[model samples]
Target: MISPDAFHAACLGLGAGLALIVAIGAQNAFVLRQGIRGEHIGPIVAVCAISDAILIAAGVLGTGALLTAAPAAVVGLRYVGAAFLITYGVMAARRILTPKALESADPESSGSSRSGRAATLATVLALTWLNPHVYLDTVLLLGSLANTQGPGLQWWFGAGAMLGSIAWFSSLGFGARLLRGFFARPASWRILDGGIAVTMVGLGVGLALGT
Candidate 1:
């Protein structure tokens, strides 16, 4: 049975978690686009939420200390993540120039291609794992905060953070269907893809420069 103080700590963690997870970023943009396209929404949401849970758990378990001791690992991840983002951005830009790529988002587009599904899965995983900001936010920040609650209550706090992750991803993924009508137009696809390309490139450059 949980005590009152532990439960209170959980509430605090939940609020903090929601505040962090609700921010706009590359992962949210990718999830929103995939959600609007109605492509592998369940799998994508599951991957993101589960990934967060794992990270949050790691943070509570003091993995942040390990990271602090191993700065080189983080540096390597930053460069690799930056490269992936830039490459994906270029692909998005290419799609804007190719009529076929733009048309693939049409309402009548078929999901019969196994390769397409695999590609989407890969992209989702990349966006989730490759971002250094995720480590900074979830592991370092959250871990430091959870430790403040003391060992007796930290796990409860982590649980609350995990719940926050699940709620935010579910709302973002499934609720994105509300924008389906707007995305139905080809012009909308062009605009969305263009924005995505710019965002990805900008983030990649920032990561590469370690800014």
Candidate 2:
């Protein structure tokens, strides 16, 4: 039988993961674009959500334990992830503050290519894979916590976390479609991106501090 601790940890994992995952970002941007365009939203969302589910589940099952069991390596990875997250957050905040003045950002960007779906999927995959903080949160922290529930509860806890990821992304992707038309103007997009940037930066900071 699963202990009360395992159940509790699983619920915490779901809440924490969803709290951060539900926000806007590069991946969320891709989902929003697809949802608005009404192009391959199902596949894109499924891929993103499923991929995230797998990673999160793996983290809980034992991967986190393996990483965390090693004192030096875990500490090293934690700091690395923290540094990356802090840097990413600062960059996101900068983008939000100087939306127009940012010379490096492309002021005019549009894509109507036939392979947009594939490109979007690839981008989401890369975004998930490249994020070190994700590993820190999902693989190390969540994983270690989930393992505490023992075998009987780990899978269930993972299921809750998986559902959290799916629900949040689905809502974000579909909800953004309705507002796509209102964002026709450059100023509108700037505001939207600015919002996303702030959210991303805020989440990034939170990840760095493990708060």
Candidate 3:
């Protein structure tokens, strides 16, 4: 049986993980868009959850200290992520301008070709790994919190955070299908892409400015 201390640590980890992830950001936005389009949901969710697990484990294993010592690495990631986000935002803007790029929300009509799947996987990987905020949040912040749980229970805390990541990505990717009816309209896609463009560009600017 799990001890009360272990359970409490796990609960705190879960809440903290959720709090960090539930915010609307580039990663979540991409996942939501893919989910709504019903494209590669499995791989997308798997990548996100697995990436979080790895990051959280690293943090708990004290990699956060290494990261802290290497401020230049984070700076590099910031510029790279900002560039990528801005480029992606411009692409989204192109989709808005090019009506031909907009497609029906029907899963059957979605891009399911091999190349499309490969591209999607690559994009998700970049979004997960390139974001410096992820390192700060999952590694530095969560790691500090987990260590505070004491050596005996830090792993339990990490496990709870991993569970939180799994549950969230699963729910976001799978639950998004429920909104298919709303996205069925092409105009709705335009609006969604518009929002994505703004979000991505704004985030890119913030990251670049180090704000």
Candidate 4:
């Protein structure tokens, strides 16, 4: 049986993890889009959850402290992420003007093909890794929080956080299929793309300006 202290730590970690990740951000937005498209949902969700697990583990291992000392590295990532977000935003905006025909979520669909899956995988990775906020939130904040649970309980806390990440990504990726009918409409896609473009560009500007 798990000890009371360990259980408490795990609960705390779970709550913190969910709180941090449930926000509507670039990463979540991309995941939602891919999920709706019904393309590479498994790989996309796996990448997100696995990436979070790795980052949370690193933080619990004290990499958060190391990152804190390397302000320059964070700044570099910020700018790079900003550029990528803005570029992607432009692409999304272009899609609004020149939308493609709504394709079914067939295995043979262009988006579900091997090359397309590869591109989607790359995009998800970039969306996860490039964002400086992820490092700050997952590595620094969550790591520090884990350490506070004391050595014996820190791992439990990290495990809880990891569980939270897995559950969330699974729910988001798999649950989005329920809305496939709504998104099947080209008008709905245009609206979604418009919103994505605005969100991406806004975030990019904020990151670039260090706001």
Residue-by-residue lDDT tens digits, candidate 2, 1-211: 6567766766876886786676555567656645655556677788878878878878866777666567666455555554544454455456546745332212124443559667766756766665555666777766766666755777667777787888877887666667756665556656655665665556556545656
Best-fitting candidate, measured by lDDT? 3
Per-candidate TM equals 0.93, 0.65, 0.98, 0.96
Over 4 Å off, model 3: none
CA-lDDT, candidates in order:
0.87, 0.64, 0.93, 0.90
| Stretches of candidate 4 exceeding 4 Å from the true structure | 101-110
Which candidate would rank higher by lDDT, 2 or 4? 4
* Candidate 4, lDDT over the whole model: 0.90
TM-score, ranked from best to worst: 3, 4, 1, 2
Please give the TM-score that candidate 3 achieves against the real structure. Answer: 0.98
What TM-score does structure 1 among the candidates reach? 0.93
Q: At residue 20, what lDDT does model 3 achieve?
A: 96
What is model 3's C-alpha RMSD?
A: 0.8
Question: Model 4: which ten-residue window has the lowest total lDDT?
Answer: 101-110
Candidate 2, which segments miss by more than 4 Å at Cα? 1-13, 37-39, 69-114, 194-211
> Which residue window of length 10 is worst by lDDT in model 3?
98-107
Clashing pairs in 4: none
lDDT of 4 by residue, 1-211 (tens): 9999999999999999999999888999998887887888999999999999999999999999998899999999999999999999999898888846445534346356678889999999999999999999999999999999866999999999999999999999988888887886788888888999999999999999998
